[model samples]
Target: MITPGQKIIQEWYKVKEWRQFPFQQEMEATYLAGYSGLLNAPTGSGKTFALFLPFLADFINKHPDYKTRKNNGLQMIWLTPLRALTNDIKKAMQEVCDDLQIPWKIATRTGDTSAAEKAALKKKLPEVLLTTPESLHLMLAQKEYPKIFQTLQVAVIDEWHELLGTKRGVQVELGLSRLKNLTPTLSKGEGANEQVVKDKVPRFYTTDALNWNANIDNAKQNRRQPTEAENVLWQFLRGKKIGYKFRRQHLVLRYIPDFICIEKKLIVEVDGGYHNDAEQQELDKYRENELIAQGYTIVRFTNNEVLTNPDNVLSKIKQILETKSNSLPEG
Candidate 1:
């Protein structure tokens, strides 16, 4: 059986649409910050590739060393909120994996996926599994689903706005929050402090966790130590902290992250001219307080700030990351 790592390595450069992305550097940077959010661009804009490519690459390289048995749990999963788009996204990722000459496996299980295929996926887990929110809920309902998600390192939910104000969105929020509690890397409870995530952030960071040199492994005695910033991270961040991640952001069909940062357990939103009306502003404040009361450190970014001087926008984000890291103790 060809591994996903092998398939992607061979096909990485061959995907026709791969050459069209120029801003992908930014997208990939955000992905590495451990922030799970949207790509926020229109369809046919190569947004999906912007989000999935680096992730597939990273998954292939990392798994060879860390790959566990199917019983170890899913390493990554994609929840689209839309059942119809599941097949399209899965095919796109599979193509990228194939072109990279790496052995990569991805499967789609929506309401549309036949019982046979779903059963097969359960037996032989794929490197990347794409499905919808409801489908994910179905997976969660299974007797063995908890074990399945034991190794989950990332969950990319597409079209977040679709679910931002709806009941389905609530379900996903609850589900991901439960998963967050289970993840080894995050603080499971609502008690996490913001100051920690801000202070410990490393500068000139990675755009995509997937793009690290595959030859280097973190387990190496010397490898664990942070290297000189310029030597390792120059390719990803273009001076300062313009890093990124291949993140997916879809809302409407079933998601909308109007109020949450899944990784940091913080909720941040950017308000702009589109929402300057008194009613909207009041509503915004209300939501911010609601998230705050829920123990989230809600940060608001003005629209002009995000568009006019994005450096300020990025800096604010850097501070948030640092604050989050610092809040954790030196254990």
Candidate 2:
């Protein structure tokens, strides 16, 4: 079964006569689930639609009367590494909005944008704004700029790999930091005046009710139908047999690892044969990096390794738990 967002994407694909790829479907589902992760695919693999269509589907799902909606300021911001690419992205996105009858305003604010146009944009922000990192900084410098992005539902950094480990990449990070701080305003007497502090990096949350419930259902299903390797490993990890309680098919943030010991912040994953594929490897690496960034130590084993040598895997996990326990400060 697919989501309404997935169904909408399928209809758009039908218009283009293009078959939707599994990765694209997963990306849309993950986005709608309020999770953030990297999409590492080869060039010219419809990466743009894999990212952009979800934004549109999410909006439509949230606003049943989107055709009549007006003055929705800056629903999305697309930051590209090259100013030249901004125009192409804007045209593509604008065409889709027109086709869907979304009634969204798409505009570009780059180094080449005229001063008069910039002044006009300042007066009324578009629903979608595509700009470079430098222009984003310039926008940040403007007075009351947060108001322009207060309604923002999504932010995309295009060509992120190219911008990594460079001065421009640092600029993008700084610009995004400022943008993430601009959250929706609460009404008076509803914690409106309270200051809520956050970390520099964005945290994952199941922001939508439908998506949250779906994830809960998935986690429950996974627990019920445990893989052979997962069941083998769980034999030793369960019931505090390893001196620490482990949860099977546990949901952490937006990910469901095979097993997780909360006290040790350790996650164990048992991968099947499909994990050997190049594309799956890239996705696994990205997922691991995201988990590591959240301060979790991960240990992975192949299905064969877990099934054939459960004792070895158990010993390794025991050693990790002992080390982690010893390293903890006195409490």
Candidate 3:
């Protein structure tokens, strides 16, 4: 019989046109089996999803109405070395939640986050929070730290290798130690009762064990090659052509954009003949909805438009960028 977690995975793969890699499947199975250990996979090899999906599936299986449930403290905490990665991870996780129709909230508590956001977090925590080691230590120092982490089910440490043998790494260890003590029910070696198991310490996962070389190789294999239209648009937008840094074949959640300008929150898709098919159009619509939910402005151009009417395509992109830039609050 297929488990609830497996069913969710099957649906996700079908929607995304993705096949689970060997290591991803192994990690997912291990997580569902209620085992916790280091996950060794290449970066961008879907490690985040492998660790996140099964845990989410289990949560949903136990609480089918989790979307309607009130905030009950944080359910997951993600740690990473750089603050910049926080938003990227948040988008990825948020995409999954949105796709699954789960109402789980996600937030970031980094040094750069505003004071207002931090204050709000203290009153009620989001379901998932992406934070740095130092920020996590600060949270632990709060008077109600125990209450804050009472519902936490998992804690993922990204780029564990960078933290392993450093002072910050030691800080993470100390923080986890205190979190374990405060939430004894969730710690490992707990009793066999279901309630006891639920209260056990949050499962810990790290990328330290991943083979760097293998990760680089896998990234190469998965990288999307630009199409003719995409290549043409890149020539005009490459190297800050429009006064903004545009990334080509940028990965946003499960979909890779043909061109993305992060600063302008813009996504450009260069379409070919296949994009006009009814089924592909449905998939494209779904993809666009996801991006729009993330507050991105999407612009699409056909292969002929980019190749034949290149100037018009560039003008339209420039107009969107300027319009968005004008709406931003001045520094």
Candidate 1, residues 264-294, lDDT tens digits: the string is 5554455445345433344455545555665
Q: Per-residue alpha-carbon lDDT of model 3 for 81-183, expressed as tens digits? A: 7778889889999999888878888899887778799899999899999998767867765666767887877778888998764434644665665565555
What residue runs in model 2 are displaced by over 4 Å at the alpha carbon? Answer: 184-331
Best by TM-score: 3
Judge candidate 1 at residue 127 and give its lDDT.
68
Model 1 per-residue lDDT at 265: 51
Question: How far does residue 328 in candidate 2 sit from its true spot (Å)?
Answer: 44
Pairs that clash in candidate 3: 42-215, 185-199, 185-200, 186-199, 186-200, 186-201, 187-200, 187-201
lDDT of 1 at 136: 64
Instruction: Report lDDT (CA) for all predictions.
Output: 0.53, 0.75, 0.73
Sorting all predicted structures by lDDT, with the top scorer first, yields 2, 3, 1
lDDT of 2 by residue, 1-331 (tens): 6666567768988998989888888888877766666898988898888999987887887788877898898888888877777887789888888888889899998767888998899999999999877677667656677676778767789999987744356556656655655643211122332443445223322223433454465677678777788888888888998789899977776566889988888999998774664434544676688788977899999999998888998889988888875423569
lDDT of 2: 0.75
Off by over 4 Å in 3: 189-331
TM-score of each: 0.49, 0.56, 0.57
